[model samples]
Target: MKQDNEAVGAQEESFSGDESQSLVPDANYQEEFSWFSVILPFLFPALGGLLFGYDIGATSGANISLQSPELSGISWFNLSAVQLGLVVSGSLYGALLGSLLVYPIADFLGTEEEGTYHCSCTIPSWGLITAYAPDLGVLLVGRLLYGLGIGLAMHGAPLYIAETCPSKIRGTLVSLKELFIVLGILLGYFVGSFQINVVGGGYMYGVSAPIALLMGIGMWLLPPSPRWLLLRAVQGKGSIQELKEKASFALSKLRGRPPGDNVSERQIEDTLISLKSSYADQESEGSFLEVFQGPSLKAFIIGGGLVLFQQITGQPSVLYYAGPILQSAGFSAASDATRVSVVIGLFKLLMTWIAVLKVDDLGRRPLLIGGVGGIALSLFLLSAYYKFLGGFPLVAVASLLLYVGCYQISFGPISWLMVSEIFPIRTRGRGISLAVLTNFGSNAIVTFAFYPLKEFLGAENLFLLFGGIALLSLLFVMLLVPETKGLSLEEIESKILK
Candidate 1:
């Protein structure tokens, strides 16, 4: 009895000691900004975003170069319009397959980290194949392989941003994927403008591969996701001591505390347990059909529909043939039309940067609505200039710039942002893959069928059709697309459920 009393006394003293120490931190403990906390975690994963940007940009120039009639007499194999369309669009569908089919298994088989590395490595190799291919058949095969890499990176990059970033800055980081994409496109144009063959023929394709490989190498230096590390602990995969140490570091990084910061072990342990419980709740609530059953279905509709609308706004058509379209409208000189394309690409870069900064501030739905509405008006003006007035070049040019600006600020970035935000964890991978597939599928249709569309509707009338789609897209945003600004994933899911 005396020994038991002594032990009880020791326990009480230890408890009191812990109570005296502020586990959560003192009121005055200054939390200096840590790169490891905010930037490192978000930045490295976004290397995938950069790779994605490079691939999209590479094709814009390369596909055009490959389709040149002059290439017909070159040492390279002969080309036809049909083969050209296949080369340009073949990658898009390859991307569709990569996203819908590959991501699920890639994600299942390894960590997002491992899956990301796999995608990155393949992208560059595909670029090399396209560069040296002897014939159109081989070239199409290269683009397809390239598309597969693009599909995985496109899907995985944003997903990483969504999963890893803190909510306050999540929009900025995820939307940065779009920013990289635009930047790559702009850079690609620079290289291709002087000599499309110089950049497009072999060198630029080869260059992009090395850059992707570098980013893949960088991926290993960053920490695995805090949530995934915690999940491992819950599943009892690693030794208890090992899991605790790693989890402690991740939790510290997430909370913006330094290694020597005065956080208690108990606090770290509590957070791990809380994560386990939260993950359990997410897993238990959904069955196989649950994604299609309830509010999840609503999320699917909004996400999928948004991408479809984004494409139908004629973004792909304009991008694929900016120079041709401008020339057709009245800028008969190729030099003048190319200048306009340069202006448009630069403008797109600027607006999307604005979006990256203001997305969380302006909110998602407002931008989508405003952007689409502006697109409709701009397209209408362009059509009016072409059809009713017999081509006022100045007015048409201004309208096209306005249309591109609105798109950059609105659908181009926001559509991607929403796809990252809308789905539940269980369906996030598959849901996003489906949305990406829709993105490429629509891109393929617009790109391949544009010639026939122009033949059927005429150029002026085509702008009008695009205008109508933009206006209708505005309605879609208003009716659907819940506001996701500043909400936790759970809170966002709850809104969808309601």
Candidate 2:
């Protein structure tokens, strides 16, 4: 890659820019990044991603046992249709509430503090309650709370990576959290599948408790976000030298700069300038409405619009109701149909792993366009197979695998990565919250509409609808989204808002 050293120190108008100072990193800064430092944030915080994914897969995977009178999935496995609907969708509704709360949480209590509370304490508490709920209503409440916790975690996890990670590999690092999500889902599937009859089928719901509790404790020990500590350092509440020391220590750990003794004198000075500039960019604390106006609007559109297309790609529908979809296509045995979900979980986990590796190398734009274009074609073929051919089970399976592959690689991970990347730090919490709101909003629409569409148009025409959306998404990426590979956060803002 060519050098843009000159661009770093140049001042530009910014919503969350460091204090009018030129604090660009030296071009070679990334070369000295430590592997240990780079991986720790993912290890400590990305566990939250695992917990979130686990909740999603755990509920759907356990649905099989819950419906099975022979197993202990749900004590009220024989509930009425209306009751079952509530049981299943309770968490998603909670997630919507959590996503919408982001702006208020940031404006009032602050995202840094609020995120810790949601992830560590709220999640574990809800998981345990859901695990041991005395009745269906209690279980529903627990599930709803679980959704709220993970919804907040989803916002916090990616935003943490976006802020801590250097721009050179931010997409890849952030996307890695997406893989942990699928891995958690995969674990939930297998865990529930193995102990189908365990604890009255409450195993899946309760399993997250220990993990979340551990995560809750781990968060207390980890340092607060450097950006956040800087934000708190407003109006000389403390010494500027002290803020720089803390920021440098945390940033060095996250970005992997050498220790003060080992770093070159000039590099140390440049690092301080960059840190100061970043702190300077923080918006005076207020409502998040500022980003919705003026130059920031472009960034918001790209962020929100990207997640909208991601949801419309039909992933939530597939995840929530894979059993019925599989059985409809030809897997007649209920146990077989349920087990196939395990296969789907594994497939998603593996493909997303590949995406974690490739996102940095190929850049975000090519992967988004390529993966979604493949998804569009797969959806069209799957629709035709279900509609016209009717009896070819293997064909349906193959098409589904192809669709899953395309989705995991493209829309699945990149959407989250871009959400964290595109927004400036000033409104990042709210920006990502809005994008997540878009994601959950689209997911809710698709999830609710899938059954109705299936009833009226059948699976064939329904998928054709998704196929059309996927095609539109391709055009959206091609024309509107920029290639954000290897650019610093401030540089990206400068380029996009220029």
Name the top lDDT candidate.
Answer: 2
TM-score of 2: 0.84
Flag clash pairs in model 2.
Answer: 16-281, 17-280, 17-281, 18-277, 18-280, 18-281, 19-280, 72-200, 72-201
Candidate 1: misplaced stretches above 4 Å? 1-33, 69-81, 109-115, 118-124, 197-204, 235-244, 249-268, 279-288, 330-336, 384-390
- TM-score for each of the candidates: 0.82, 0.84
Q: Which stretches of candidate 2 lie over 4 Å from their true place?
A: 1-26, 29-34, 72-75, 79-82, 107-112, 120-126, 166-168, 197-199, 235-283
Candidate 2, 100-174: lDDT as tens digits: 876576544443455576665455456677777778888888877877876777777665665565455555677
What lDDT score goes with residue 308 in model 1?
Answer: 96
Error of 1 at 200 (Å): 6.7
State which candidate has the highest TM-score: 2
**lDDT to native, each model:** 0.65, 0.69
